[model samples]
Target: MNTPHTIVETTLVPHTAFEEATQRLEQCFSYADGASEPICIALVGESRTGKSRALEECFTRHAPIRQPDGLTTPILRVKTPSKPTVKSLAELMLRALADPRAYSGTENAKTSRLLKLMNESGVKMVMIDEFQHFYDKGSHKVMHHVADWLKVLVDDARVALVVAGLPTCRAVIDQNEQLAGRFLSPVFMPRFDWQDTDQREEFIAILGAFQESMGEAFDLPAFTGDEMAFRFYCATGGLIGYLTKFLRQAVWNAIDAKTTTIDLANLLRAHSEAIWAKDGPTGLPSPFDRRFSTAATDDLLARIKRIGIPAEEIRLPRSKAARQTGALGVQAVLTAR
Candidate 1:
């Protein structure tokens, strides 16, 4: 029986966009209730660039930026509303407020009630994710309305807004010039650029470091040259998320075979299975191409290699056969460099 070894949990990698966004996100939690003015931030990036993950971190952490005051900081996170209309948007706010008495009667009245709830709840920030749907499916009129409605919400609620979505979401915000002023900082997440040698090398170093770290637990060999790296770069356009998927798959295959070290053969086999990524392992691209991740590949892998994990040194089978044989205590994989 073969157990899947490729599946990794919480892969470690330095995603620049995610890192930069963390600082800006901290600002949202920094302000006190009604003490600071409103702020708005937009996350713009192509598919699979980790924009969603950056926004989702706040939700997963659930720790609001505490202010000088002892009061708990308030954070409201919501995805774009389905069937977004002035009415629906208002209702969405009401629901997220989780305050039953916040809204009542007609739309206008509900808006008033929602404003009251925001004030009453001391809500400091509102994060709307997947906001690009309106631009993708709705008309110009709908887009404009959503923009105007958001501005009004920001002013009335006196809370910051942090939105994350696809690059098309940029078009939606640009259309509403007023909205741009509201969100002065627009985070742009782009695919990894392989043309820059220094950048590529730095990324490689990170992966090498990681290899060292994991070496104690597993014998992952050093990745030499640009052959496989370039191949992965071409397929992923340097997208961190995509690169990780490819490398993880390769390592997984090597482990399953119980190979002493990862090599090009195992990598190719893994690439073939990554149909959504590079040309499949056999170098064939399927009709579909939709895969993504958030960490740069080379950089991430290098970091793994540098961690200097301790792996039990293996003796050559033939030479050691003259004596008793036994594999001993656990250790981490160490970096050759």
Candidate 2:
């Protein structure tokens, strides 16, 4: 089975949005070191649009610097708890700092330890992914207490705060004017635009890059072919994360079935089984059927290849509502008195 090999070959594909986000993060990282006040920046996007990945890439670039004094983490990254409470948030930070006794204290105690560790560890920046957890959507409440706590902690520490989360995170940040004012303009990582001439070429180039990276290993199908590329884009709704996911599964399926090549059929089956199997019908046309091909698809592809079109007039596919990444429970946020 090509399982082991295929798993190793799966890698991050750098497209336009990812690259741009990385550049902005680099600037943020540099600005954190000497800023007079704590710097805040929000990385906002739909789930699976690479917000977390971009933050992670920046974190990796500026890893902990070990010295005789101690290990100095330049960028401390952690994910918010699934159920966000003041206690849980403190515990998350403590755990990320490698404190064994992360869960051993009251909320106030944990908060003290969190701040102490951040200073002692020489943490210059903090990155919290899935930050939207701080807001409870079902109850329509913002965790004002937690937000105030964070604002105080960051100000005291004087470290940059890099928060990445879903679009809903904007609401959480907006509720606190003091917290919201600290943040620089948010960097939005949008999905690929199929109708935009430059974006389409860049998207296709990303597909070509993936094929070049993995094609020879498995005798993969022509992913960059005009029709195949359009189909892949449609299947993935132009999200690189989904595109990579679909391709990875298709590769594994090809290997397990002892097939020599990945074809449209393999991809179609992979789509139905993996991507949207549980979501039910999306009311969108299937990209797999030959009869599903239309003049609209052709014209879109034509515009993409030619890179000639009125930028304002070109009609692109509308984005579907953002999918929930996990099941949210019946919970309420603690508002500040």
The best candidate by lDDT is: 2
TM-score of each: 0.64, 0.82
Per-residue accuracy of model 2 over 185-291 as CA lDDT, tens digit each: 99998766777878778778888887776666666677777777777766666666677777777777777887657666787877776675422224445676675
Model 1, 103-213: lDDT tens digits are 456777887887877776677778888888658443444367767877888787788888887766777777777787666668887665555676677556546655654
TM-score leader:
2
Backbone clash pairs for candidate 2 read none
lDDT of 1: 0.62
Worst 10 residues of 2 by lDDT: 322-331
